[model samples]
Target: MSNPGSYPLPDRFDAVLAEQDAEGYRCRFAPVALSDLPDRDVLVEVRYSSLNYKDALAVTGRGKIIRQSPMVLGIDLAGRVVSSGSSRFRPGDAVVVTGQGLSETEWGGYSPWQRVRAESLIPLPPAFSLAQAMGIGTAGVTAMLSVMALERYGLAPTPRPMVVTGAGGGVGSMAVALLARLGYPVAAVTGRAALHDYLTQLGARQVLDRSALAQASPALGNERWAGGIDSVGGKTLAYLLAHTAAHGAVAACGLAGGADLPVTVFPFILRSVGLLGISSSSTPAAAQTQVWRRLARDLPASVVDSISRVEPLSRIFELAEEILAGGVRGRIILDVRA
Candidate 1:
């Protein structure tokens, strides 16, 4: 429970939507009744939300991200607790919720209020404000998990160059910045040469063309990459696989290129290279807790300005279209109340 002034509930809200239109997706707002929200242990007055690639897919119907229509469509949020039915959280607690069906099977965080399962929420780390958390959001969490996986599996070693593909995109950019900040020499690969300066500013020692990695060939070709954080799957993933150094690993998350991983097993068999699957959406509870803590501490505070674009809730639909077209850089944060 919360006092009125501290965590008073939102009385009304306008839920943002990507309506199906004759031309394509149209940005619109629809009135929502707070009573219509799903039953959950916590009611959050969402102060901040952010956009993801999945959100774009959902809005454009390029892919089916939302299982239900006329659904609210932000996948990540951070805010103060307005109401709590669980002992873990009380009114006034600052918390975050990510990747539990978010913009898919249930209501998400694109509105002024959100209902979430208590177990799915984590206390906002003391090191970052709620806005900072959303700036990192799912993209930051994914990057941390990938980096940690490389370390745990012995794929990462000091003095070896780590590579990040899709270096201009959210997960990729965050991974590059995070790795470089931690003293690893980073080779960033991206389609846009214009972002070369941007990637280098984030600590990438070198930036490569997307075609430099290309697609992998049968068996293997080059002994490169200590290990890699890859957000573009398909051929790009295969390229990393074929070229990863002996005993190197590639931690893969997004399917932006394609879901089909067309690759030869030579890297896995001969080089002992490993392809690690990082599924942030359904990561186990214990692991989820560990990764966020890492993000709060290991990731630098300067990263937010380099990798974040802020927007009002009203602009999500237009932004979604741009992101899907590969025109977006870094992360997009949504100010739900703005």
Candidate 2:
């Protein structure tokens, strides 16, 4: 069946909505009508969306990721412009909308229909399908940015390993895949020995256990890494700092482990190690465009399929439970129209 005044809809328009339960947490979506959507500048008929750790937390009510009640839960949306009020885009324009507080401060892309602010819209990269763009999503963008930061600081082909903490997770996996595709020797750090094989397939030449770093104190440790992409934060970052080779760089993201880093100044003071902070929120538009272009050109075609898991919007409630429990693998792309 066609939607009342927008794109085609089947018998139902699938979406994931979160509501606060008296007991604790709850999420579900009924057959939402298009006319029932909140008003905004551009009405996007979302075809595909993707999850990040933030989306997981928002769906579960575990962290305060969602600021409003009865919210749709999805952070990244890739879809066609069903209609638009802005001059910049018109009907049928492909777009990637992400990280403008979707599923957090506002209703987001879990719905098949969404009203997005036109200014937040980004035209899809020419090299990607709408689904493929969502498959990469915010995680891939952040990963590319981290790798870009390292490359900016002279991460070259060297005998020393470039360690990636939390290598089994989304950003870490993409980082591993991107770095390896670019001819860097990547060492993935994960406590899950089982994912060693999986990480290896994603381009990690070696895998290190998280606990091995926990026992070592780091004014300086083994001059192990040429550089690193540390997504786990906390002690993992401290360890990476201690272990990075002389004059090496590390792009610090995520706080999966914890935010606290108990460290001394030895790595920076003695080794001239560089700790580069890669932030997505304040990244310049031109730089963002540059990074996306790099990802389109360099990320292997196989990596899109290799690092992604597909799920329906209705499954997000359960998916969040798994993410919080640290049981999810790779990138999980949400099929919003299903």
Candidate 3:
């Protein structure tokens, strides 16, 4: 094990902690001692973490994202190793950790310092800096995973166009950019009309109002798209399934809209539409590596910068409210070290 004294380790660091009290659940930025962290194989000095829908939900107490109390509350982090017990990593190694039950069952990334299992960390790809890696973060990984699922199902780029729901959010924005960069026409769907121009700037060929697909979808509607990456579940997912072209596939990654599936199996029986579920939190290590590699190759840093902004970790609560209110346009990177 590397000597922790070799690094300029802080006795205490700031983190966003969520806990349930006699009063109620509360999330706040507080100082945490290094010893308070779990006894994991690697001690990381987190440089950047990104705000995701899940993080917002947890911080705002809107969703039961934190299964454990006194939990750190950021799902994605990019940083450098300060000390390591495993041979796979040494002090000063750059790494990224996303999902793997972060902010839920395990302590997560909303801290300047955190102890993580070595297996949960991925060496930062040479294509991205620590900040850039967080910019892609959990959301990018989910979007890439969705695209890979669609491709594995034999869906390809074509003139039929691919739809991305919740297009103003992190995953949807990344999906729009990824699909468009892969030569597929992208129709970005958002509830906020103000984000139309922003979505287009992220490579959306067309931007549609959320109401276009948020209504009560029939069992089978006209084939409007070849396929899609859906982050909004419920009506939006139902609509995608109902209108997807024959043999098309829809990758469902989130339920920001709602969780219920209101449509029947007509789309599946009549059109052979495949609904692929993407659970990014528990994706295997090998698949996570593949997703990162694909993201490095396909997602340009410039586009990432255009769609993302950096904010201090102190503003996490305000940002969480903004995200939940559907006011945030793209990804928000938390400068943990700030």
Candidates in order, TM-scores: namely: 0.93, 0.90, 0.96
Leading candidate by TM-score? 3
Q: Give one digit per residue, the lDDT tens place, for model 3 in 1-338.
A: 34443346778877899899886569988889989999898988888999998898899888888897889899999988888889999988899998988899889999988899888889888988888888889999999999999999999998998999999999999999999999999999988888878888888889998887889988888998999999989988999999999999999999989999898989999999999999999996667988999998999988988888999988888988998887887799999876
Best by lDDT: 3
lDDT of 1 by residue, 1-338 (tens): 46433334555668876565466555467778878678988888888998889877876677767666557777788988888899998888888877777877767888888888888888888878888888898898899999999888885446768889989999988999889877889999999999999999999999999986666555587777788999888888888888888888999998878898889788999989988989887875467788888887877666776699788877777888888888898988888876
Model 1, runs deviating above 4 Å: 1-10, 17-27, 216-218
User: Which pairs, if any, clash in model 2?
Assistant: none
Evaluated against the true structure, the overall lDDT of model 1 is 0.82
TM-score-better candidate, 2 vs 3: 3
* Residue 243, model 3, lDDT: 94
* Residue 41 alpha-carbon offset, candidate 2, angstroms: 1.9
Pairs that collide in candidate 1 are none
Worst 10 residues of 1 by lDDT: 1-10
Candidate 2, run of 10 with poorest lDDT: 1-10
The reply for model 3, stretches above 4 Å from the true place, is 1-7
Q: For each candidate, C-alpha RMSD in Å?
A: 2.4, 2.9, 1.8
Q: What is the lDDT of residue 197 in candidate 2?
A: 89
Q: Find the 10 residues in a row with the least total lDDT in model 3.
A: 1-10
